[model samples]
Target chain A: MLKNYFKIAIAVLKRRKFFTFISLFGISFTLTILMVLTAFIDKVAGDNYPDKKRDRLLYVNRIEQKGKDNMNSGTLSYYFLSHYTAMMKTPVKVAISSGFSGTNTYVNNKKIAVSYKYTNAEYWDVMDYDFTEGKPFNKQQVDNADRVVIISEDMKKQYFGDAGPVVGKYFEADNVSYRVIGVVKNVPVTSYMFFSDIYMPYTTSKADYKSKSYGGGYMGVLMAANKDDVPKMQAEYENLMKRVPVESKDFQHLYSHANTFFSSYVDTGNEGTSGVFIVVTAISIFVFIFMLLPTLNLVNINITRIMERSSEIGVRKAFGASSKTLVYQFIVENLILTLLGGIIGTILSVIVLAVINNADLIANLQLSINFTVLFIALLVCLVFGFLSGVYPAWRMSKLNVVTALKAQ
Target chain B: MIRLQNIEKVYRTDTIETLALNSVSLDVAKGEFLSIMGPSGCGKSTLLNIMGLLDVPSKGSIKIADKATENLNDKQLAQFRNKTLGFIFQSYHLINDLQVLDNVELPLLYRDTTAKERKMLATEALEKVGLANRVKHFPTQLSGGQRQRVAIARAIVGRPDIILADEPTGNLDSAMGNEIMDILINLNRNEGTTIVMVTHDENMAHKTHRLVRLFDGSQVQ
Candidate 1:
């Protein structure tokens, strides 16, 4: 029986080619844009590559260390991380690293700019940087403030023109010379925390390097032994936070949180709700509104189709079909249409993502559809089918049999 | 086996209330071939729609096969229409999208009949209507008389107890009309299928077992 309905639906669609084309165009275009957007968001917010241990990692990107009268709110200083964060017991490793800062200098006598970060030895131990040449600088080199650095493969090629093992070479950065100790894989720019063109030890750059202030241009990345240790470590850190000696006279209050990637991004400490929640809610509402016009247009097309098939519906109803039967048939027809359009949209979105990746629209941008994205696309198709199919089916079902039969 | 008592149908607008049927009572006997005759706007189609359960009367008591129909819900009414009654319209109302065989098989679709069984029954009905060779032909490919035959095949395919035809031959020539009349008469005389048909042709009405006349929403004879 359902096969019969499908057959009739196909025939009807074939009979009305222009209308079917318009409907398919609307559905496919709407879904394509949505899918591409979802893929982009997924790549940025989701865990990808060397940060795979993100689940067990807590980040302290911001800190507010308050004294009696003056509150210092900023990224944690190297002194604060060394004194306070290194003492965290639950973390398997507490890594201190400066945020990537863009630096320009003469490399091979050509003016070049690179994003670089300074870190201690544990930054390498906690991070999984795949080395292509030599190896990471050890504790001795970092402790002794040796002029050594780890450069990305792209940076290595840029400086040495693909020279083999450029580990023993010197590169000029911000007028300071550092010998390349290792070459690592290029990190995608999407990984904001880990993406850097070059890395050096913190001691190499002297800027009040031993200051004990609790605020600066550094962040502490904590790797716990287990995911469950996150909250426990945070609690212990908070408890120890209260006992910290405050010498400042103006700012008195100090507060900070150890947050996961999402929690850190959505820090409720800054807003009434998590920024991630707010962002997700806002995007969902925007997408829904974005889908409204197309969905309504499809619904209007469905209504027209129903009107055109009134005589057929009349004949079916006269033969003892209930309103439920008519509604079911029409909705199934709508589902078939949307499913077809969804397949087309998904294909188009994949092609679009490939184009974006190939064009390097964003540096090292790697966007691909995974199982979750596929599931979302399927969900969109179902919702679209139901939204566009229901009202028209119901309206057609309520039509007067006599009037419908009389309709041409 | 049908009974109607004090059936009245009122069609209303914002400022107008037109009576389409005025307290009409009717009874159709088993194996009876009944024909109804009336001029246009005499409520013939309204009366037939009520009998077919396609529309409800403003005031009426209807009984079909000893079951009261006044309180029958939409589901029950549809079931009754599917299992007990079949309809043939003046325009034939054969779905243009379907083949003749599919058209005949429609009434059986709502039933619990399997696909293979439905095909077999539809084949038999189409053969009876002399459309055996044209089972797969669409309605647009058929002549007016052939479309009417397909409609009749659909009507009788369910083996319904009652067949209500509204001007079954109104669109056909005299010869095609007579041929349809012969099929209805033969079904009534041989199979005891109760048939109530509305027609304007005096010749067709006079050939039925009984003739009913209506004028201005009222029974005149």
Candidate 2:
């Protein structure tokens, strides 16, 4: 029965070459758009932080007002740490880090400038950076730190030779002697922290700069103990905030203080730009519908073919051809066309994705036809085939043989 | 054998009801070669259709091979047709997309016959109709007479007990029509299969063993 269905379906398609081509093209076009967009979205949402235990890591931001205006700010300072360190009832470990915006020029007979981040001893443990040379800043170094910095591989190569061992070596920058404590790998382009080139101990920067509000800098906290304790820790921190003495009720009224943490720091604005995705989805639907239209055209064509064969139907009825048998044959023919179309469409989609990926317009995009997308494409084709074929098959099966044979 | 008692068929329209077969009764013995002849609107094809199980009568009891067909569902009626009847049509109805061999093999496809067996049987039928050399040729590639022969091969491929031909030679020239008639005659004489045909030409009607005539949806003689 299956062979018969396929045989008939192949015959029908061969007979109507134009229609078959149109149907296959439309379906493939739709599937390609859908698959490519889905691959891109998957890349954007979960690309960089695959190994990070993001659920246990929290980034703290202070939402506070300055003067008469309302402001939502992310930068925190050492003032927050001094207040929260004693007040917190939980064992949640916090790390304070500050990134300097200005570029520093290293004299290699020529000026090589790079941006740097100054962080405390906890920064290395929190970020989990694997150093290539030397060691991380020690707690004592952060508490009473002097001229020491960890430079990236790119910075070392620019200021020193490519094979030069920069660690334990001094380089003059910003009119100060800075010793390279370690050389680290270059940060990946996809990462959010792409600008920082050097790391300096936080205490050295604080003492030199005389900034008392270090707690209000960008603070990232890691709860390595367990995730289930987060709600309790957050509640305890909020409760501890109420106990801090306020200078005046009016001062308290002017500042609406709330603390919130992000588990992952993606530029939410960049991440939320799904306009391309929407356009892709809409085009996919349109192509699917366009493909279905051609199938409907095939149905109309089948009706005419069936009418042309009405006498044969009558003769078959006379010779004991069951309506069920007729229905089965028609369905088999439809399934065969659709299955062939599905194969062609899948091939076309792969080619289309490959071409688009090679265009280099979409950043870091990789489109591969995975099992999930293939299954979905085949399923869609089958459903479309079944739906398109049902009505015509039923109509052909119900044909009244005597009247059909007798008609002029 | 076939029996029909008080059969009536009325076709209803929005504003009119036309009777195609009315209070008709007939019997046909096994291995009989009978032809039904009538003018236009005379229900000759309608009677043939009822005998073929292609259409049901408005009021009648039909018995074919001692089985009552009045209560048979569409599926059972189709089974009955496949197992007990064969058909030849004026237009050939050879399924133009298929080769002559595949078209001939269609009837057996509905049966549980395996591919190898169906191919053998269809080849034998085509051979009988002198079309063995043309098995791979499509219907469109054949002449009108050759196409009819392919249709005949398809009908007999299942070895049905009855053969129903409606205007079987209407689309052919006289020479081709006579050739088809000769084939039908030889099959009837040699195989002892029951044959019922409907025709408008008097000369063709006279060639059959018995001729039944109808007018105004009723038998006149």
Candidate 3:
């Protein structure tokens, strides 16, 4: 029976070429845009290299120091990170890294710009960076303020002309000469926490690293022992935050919490508003509003399309079909069209992503329709199909048999 | 095989009420071939539709094959129609999207029949209608008489106990009309299947076992 329905659906589509073209165009165009958008979002926020342990990791990037009238908002200081987060018993490991800063250097007559970060040895253990040559600096190097650095693949190609081994090479950035001890794969700019052209030991930095002040440019990373220990770690961090004494007279209250990467990215430093909730609700609303117009258009087109077959509907009713059966048939027909559009959309997304990747539209960003994106695209197709198909099918099913038969 | 009592069908807008069928009662016994003849504005087609369970009368009860059809729900009515009744319309009402064999197999799709059984039954029905060689042809590819034959093949594909035809031969030339009439006559005589047909031609009416005439929604004879 379904085979017969498919055959009839194909014939109907073939008969009404213009209607089929219009419907397919709308469905495929909308799906292509949706899929490409999802792919970009997934690439930006989804778990990738270095942040692979995101599920079992928490990030503490921002601290709010509030007095009665003065409010200070910035990243946590090295003192606060080393003193409090290092003492937390719930986490398996705690790593600290100063926020990235841009630096300029000249190589052979051309000027080069690079973003660099100073991280301790434990930062390497917390992140899962794939090293192409040599290894990360040890704790002793960080403690001794060793002038050693790890550069990304793209940086190595730019500074060293893609020739010789980058390990044991020397380069200067921000007027500080450093010996390269490792070369790692390039990380996309979207992975902000782990994305930098040059990585150096925190001790080599000229800034104040031992200050007891509560505010500075530093981020602490906490790794849980297992996935199930994430919430326990967060609770432990919260308890620790409550016990922190005011280090400076400038602030009467200190607010800081450990959060997942996404939550930290969207954090507004407000206790009442959950970043996850806000982001989720905002995305849901965006998708809903984005799909509404096309769905309405498809519904209108489907009503006219089904009406053209009113006589067929009447004949089926007169023969033996129940209203439920006719409705099911029409929905199936609509699903076929939408799924075909989904296939076309998927192909179009692949092409678009390739063009963006090849064109270097975004620095170090490579987007692809991975499994998650494909699954979401398929779900969108089904939801779009069902939402667009149900009403018209219902209206067609409610058609009076005699009146439908009389319709032209 | 069929019964209707005081059937009344009214078409009403906000201000006017026009009756399509009024105070009409009918009975068709088992294996009886009956024809209903009337002018264009009469209720011949409306009565046929009522008996076929395609439309409900405003104030009436219907019984088909001894089952109280008026009380049956939509699903039950459809199943009952699937098992016991067949219909052939004047315009052929053949789905242009389906081939001849697939069109004939439509009624069986609602039943619990297997695909193989449906194909065999549809092929057999088409063979009986003398269109066995045109199974792959679409309705538009067939002539008017041939399309009617395919419609007849569809009507009998389920081997229904009663077949209701509304102007089955109205769109065909006399020769093609006679060919369709012969098929119906053969079906009635050989299988003892009851038939209720609506027509405007006296010659076609005389071909049936009995004739009932209607004028302006009322029975004149």
Candidate 4:
């Protein structure tokens, strides 16, 4: 019986080639755009920071007030780190780090601009950075290190040719010679911070600044304890701050992780581009709704076709086609049309996503469909098919045979 | 084998009430060939529709093959119709999108018959109508006479006990009309299939074994 229904559906669609084409085209086109947009968003969000130990890590930022100029920065001061480490009762390992600056290097007179950062020894233990060659700077090196540095793959390629070994090689930056102890893989663009070509010891930076305490300087900390203990640790750090030598007592603290930091920043409207994203999302939803109009038109066309075939329906009803059978046949026909449309739409969406991602007109953007995106598209097609078929199927099954046959 | 008792059908609008079938009652014996003849607006078609279980009677009961139709639900009535009765229409009413063979196979699609069986039955019915050569031709490609033959094939493919034809030859010329009558006569005589046809032509009415005429909403002589 099911096979018969499918055969009849195929015959009906083949008979009205133009109508079937239009309906399928409408549905597929809409689905493709929706899928691409959702995939792009998911890619940008970075899959919710998939590290299993994410909950144990804490990101620290500061809300500073200096002479009526208030700035909420994700980076904090190094002075607060020293104070928090000494005063906090919890045995949490704290790592303070800061973004790398673009430094011009003259290796054998071949000048190259490289991004580098200065951080304590604890920085290596807190974040996961893969090493391709050599080893990380140890506690002893960080304690006595004024000439040690880690070089990334790109930096190694630029300073030491492709075949040459970068480890144990000496490089000069700002007239300061430093030995590369380790070579790290180039950071992926998907990471929050893109600039980290080289990393230097915190002792080297501390000597340059000529201060045992860094005040009002760019810094960030990560807690190496369980996330559930964060609030308590944060409170203990706050109390520890009062006894430390600091210029301002009005510094505000915020606790977050790699996942929540970016999401919360977007949600709180802290990022300037949040409004743009919201507008884009709203427009995409509107486009999705507009796409549904074409599906509804197809439904209306189906209803008209069903009416024209009323006598056939009458005959079928007279021949023992129950209302359920009629309704099932109609629904199956529409679902087949929708599924076909969904496939076409998915293909089109992939092309669109590729085009958008490769256009290079949009800055720092990549769009592609993922598993989640495909699932959502399929779900949309199902909902659209069911909603569109309801009235038509009902009307088709409710047909009166006697009236129809009489007209014939 | 069919019986109608006090069948009434009323069509009501906002300001007027029209009676299409007024308390008409009749009986048809097994293997009977009956023709209903009436002028326009004479309720003959309405009576046929009511008898076919396509329309509910305003007041009355219908029995087919000795089973009461009043208690039968919509699904049961459809089952009864598909299993026990066949239909032929004046317009042929072949789905234009489908080929002649597919149109003929439609009635059997509701049954649990396999595809191969359905194809064989539909093919035999088409052959009986002398349309075997045009099985693959769509309705649009067929002549008016050919379309009606296909319709008849579709009606009989299910092997129903009774065939109800409403103006089966109305759209055909006299020659084509005669060809259709010949098929009906053959089916009745050879297969013992009861036939209830509605027509206005007296010549067509005379060919049937019994004739029931109607005027306005009531039956005459």
Clashes of each: 11, 15, 0, 6
Best by DockQ: 3
Residues A43-99, model 1: lDDT tens digits: 877845566678788887877755555556667789887788767788888888888
**DockQ of all candidates, in order?**
0.64, 0.61, 0.70, 0.64
What residue pairs clash in candidate 3, if any at all?
Answer: none
The TM-score ranking, best first, is 1, 3, 4, 2
Q: Worst 10-residue stretch by lDDT in candidate 1 chain A?
A: A265-274
Alpha-carbon deviation at A198 in model 4, angstroms: 4.5
- Which parts of model 4 have CA positions greater than 4 angstroms off? A14-22, A44-52, A62-74, A89-92, A99-118, A139-164, A168-182, A193-312, A349-369, A402-408
Error of 4 at A176 (Å): 6.7
> What is the DockQ of the complex in model 3?
0.70
Instruction: Please give, for residues B1-221, the per-residue lDDT of candidate 1 as tens digits.
Output: 88989999999999999999999999999888999999999999999988988888999888887788888876777788899999999999988888888889999999999999999999999888888999889999999999999999999999999999999999999999999898888888888999999999999999998999999999999
Order by lDDT, highest first: 3, 1, 4, 2
lDDT of 2 by residue, A222-283 (tens): 35456676666666655655564443332342121222222233322222333345655675
lDDT (tens digit, per residue) of candidate 3 on A48-132? 6787789899999888878887788878888889899877898888888987889888899888899899898999998989999
- Cα lDDT, all candidates: 0.86, 0.71, 0.89, 0.75
* DockQ measured for candidate 1: 0.64
The TM-score values for the models, in the order shown, are 0.89, 0.76, 0.88, 0.82
Model 2 stretches with alpha carbons more than 4 Å out: A48-51, A58-221, A226-321, A365-367, A402-408
Docking class of 2: medium
Fnat computed for model 4: 0.78
Whole-model lDDT, model 2: 0.71
User: Which candidate gets the maximum lDDT versus the true structure?
Assistant: 3
